[model samples]
Structures are given as C-alpha cells and as structure tokens.
Target: MRGLRKYLTPFAPDQSGAVSVLYELGGIIVICDAGGCTGNVCGFDEPRWFERKSAVFSAGLRDMDAILGRDDRLVAKLVDAADKIDANFAAIVGTPVPAVIGTDYQALKRMCEKKTDLPILAIDTDGMELYDKGEEKSVSCIIYCICKGKI
Candidate 1:
C-alpha cells in the first residue's frame, strides 16, 4: 500500500521530549546524537525554545565514536561545554545511537563529576520511543537524583 503521509513526518521522539523537560532548569542539556536531534528539539518540539534560553547542546557523536564506545571523548566535550557555561547541573539525554551501543550513563555521569562539580541528571531515552516515554524517564530520573542527593 502507498503511504499517504507525504506532507507529514515522524512524530517527535522521546529524545526531544527528554530535552524539553530540562528546558526551564538552569542546567546544561546535552543531547547525545550526531547533531540533528538537538535542532529538532529546539526548532520544532520545544515551543518555548524561542522565548527562553537554556544551555542545550549536542554531543556531536561520530560513527566511530559510537561504535568504539569512546565515552571519554564525550566526557571531555561535556566538561568543555560546562566550563564555558554557568550551569547548576548537567543532563545527558540519550538517542538511538547511544542506546544501540549501550552507553553507560552512570559511568558517564561519574566521569563528568570528576571533571566538573556540576551534578549530572541522566535521561535514559532511545529515539525509537514516543515523547511521553522520554519525558517520564527524565522526570523520574530527576526525582531519583534529587532524593539520593546526587543533584
């Protein structure tokens, strides 16, 4: 059967929603993708993106980095960005690339902590799911981090 949704595209994924959850918080939001996911979140998914300012960024994950599990490189980039910006915390929102590679978010958070004093907020999201799933995970993680005194 021919698809009738030529004018439409895939709905906003969980990754973008995860970023949106932290939009108001004064923290560095890092979208763990090659690049486009951040654009989508800021340009399309996030309605308040234009009206407000946040420290959202992309990890710029390359194919080799994902395949080889070069998490130290990611930690370096996060530390560099954090150094340049004033943030109270840091949130790592995962995408399909990291999910496929089984990125260890807990380890990443620990490495980031060693590099910087900012608390780490992890949103475990894979691009395959819907927006609500990511938002839910993000909220849950934030609550968990807060209760555990990690954030």
Candidate 2:
C-alpha cells in the first residue's frame, strides 16, 4: 500500500460515465461485464433508461469467456447487434472484468470495424476510475476515431 490511499475516489465508475455520454448518441453501448456493471447503470446510475431509448447492452460475458480471453466472441456479438440495430456506431465500454484480463480495446475495435459497417468506439474503462474520466475517454474516442479518421 505504498502509494494507495485509504479512501476511494468520490466519483462514479467509468462505465456509468461512458454510458451517460453515449446514452443519447444513437449508438450501441456495450458494457463489457457479466451483468453487474450494466445493472448498476440501469438500476442506479442511469434512471433515464425508462425515458430515453439507447441501444445499450451487456456483453453478457461468462466465466470462461474472460478466462480464455475470448475477444473474438465479443467482436462477433457486437457485429451481430450492429447489423440488427440502426446504429451509427458501436461502443465497447470496459469494466473490471476486461481490465483484470488485460483486454486490448484497440484490437477489439479493429476486429469490430472489419466485420461491421458501423464505427466502433472501444473505451477501455476499468470500473475503478472516476465517472468523469470515462466521459473524457468516450469523448476522446470520438475525436480520435472520427476527427483523425482512425475509423
């Protein structure tokens, strides 16, 4: 605990912030968690789920999926959802699960981009970070992918 503080940050997790920024952006926002993160977003963080219509979903990652680093399966699921939904882009918002597993969001973005026509915004947001950080991340992703044509 050399550099660790006793108190946790006074901000919400990045997943909540990521979803907030993209909630009305007309794209599919996927929470890369088993279910807890997504539940937090809908049940607590974002109460607008009842009023606003966003294509937010959970990757529904299972135990072995994370253990085996099943990036392909996630990419496939994203692409399939993009095909069915009329979305301009797709966002993969990371949580503690992917963070612990060392998920490479850039590679996932590339994989999703190759398979789907929609632009993919992969925000590698671990649940430990503040909500504003995730908001900044999602905005940065837009700038990097759209402004710089990384898409």
Candidate 3:
C-alpha cells in the first residue's frame, strides 16, 4: 500500500488550485478513514479544500478499536473533532484494515448523527478492494444514498 505522505504530500503543491475550485462550488469536505498509516495520507490533500470551504472533519478508527468493536471511541473522537472544526456534516471513509475486520460503520453513523446533529455519510472503501473498485463503490454508494434521501 502507498504511504499516506506519498498521496497527501503532493497536494501541497496544488492546494491553491484545489481550494479555489472547491470554494467556488461551496460545501463541506471530509475524508473518512481508519487510523491506518496510509489512510491519513489519502486525506492530506483535503485539509486545504476543507479549510477553504470552512468545514471539514475526520473520524479515525484505531486497530484495536476495529477488532474489538469499540466504535464508540471512534465516534467520540469524531464528535470532538467535528466540534473543533465546526463541521456542518461529516464523511466516513473506510480503510483496508476496517474493511478486513468488518467494523460496524452503520452503528457509528447513527451514533455520530445522534450526538452531533450533523449529517454523516458512511463510505465503504475497503483496502482489499482494488483502488478503482473501491473508489467507484464509494462514489456510487454516496450518489445512490443521496438520491434515495438516505444521507
């Protein structure tokens, strides 16, 4: 798997461009992930985009938490982080590790919404799934869920 820095670092050079585009469009921006080494990297490019929109949050799932079904910790962390950033909504993106362990994302979603009164989107992007496959699945799910009024 690629290192988080590898994916996130390059975006620093392009931050201005990405932020400008997202700002013009307007909306919350979030990158969900388990607390994997690489998952954070996937999000490196997002902070700038998020900062521009003035809304962003991350929910980091720990390894032990994933195996033990301790999604509450993740939920708490997410809530705290969301509050710190004052995010309007949050996005939940999965990493390879959580997918393998079968984390109960649905429950986490419910908890986050109940606690924060903010919209939560749970995206399944298990690492074992091919890159494109995961991306497509996550995007499709988000679209379908939105159109169905599930989000």
RMSD, every candidate, angstroms:
3.2, 2.6, 7.3
Across residues 1-151, which tens digit of lDDT does each residue of candidate 3 receive? 6765532322222212222232332224343344333334335533443444444333455556667878777777777776776454565666556666776667867888898866776665554433445445555655765797755
lDDT by candidate, in order shown: 0.88, 0.88, 0.53
Pick by TM-score: 1 or 3, better one: 1
> What lDDT does candidate 1 reach at residue 74?
88
**Candidate 3's C-alpha lDDT?**
0.53
Residue-level lDDT tens digits of model 1 in 1-151? 5876553224799988788788898999999999988888889999898898888899999999899999998899999998999888999999888997899988998899899999998788888888888889989988998899987
TM-score of 3: 0.60
Question: 123, model 3: CA deviation in Å?
Answer: 0.7
Q: For every model shown, what is its TM-score relative to the native structure?
A: 0.90, 0.90, 0.60
Per-residue lDDT value at 16 in model 1: 80
Looking at candidate 2, the ten consecutive residues that score lowest on lDDT are: 4-13
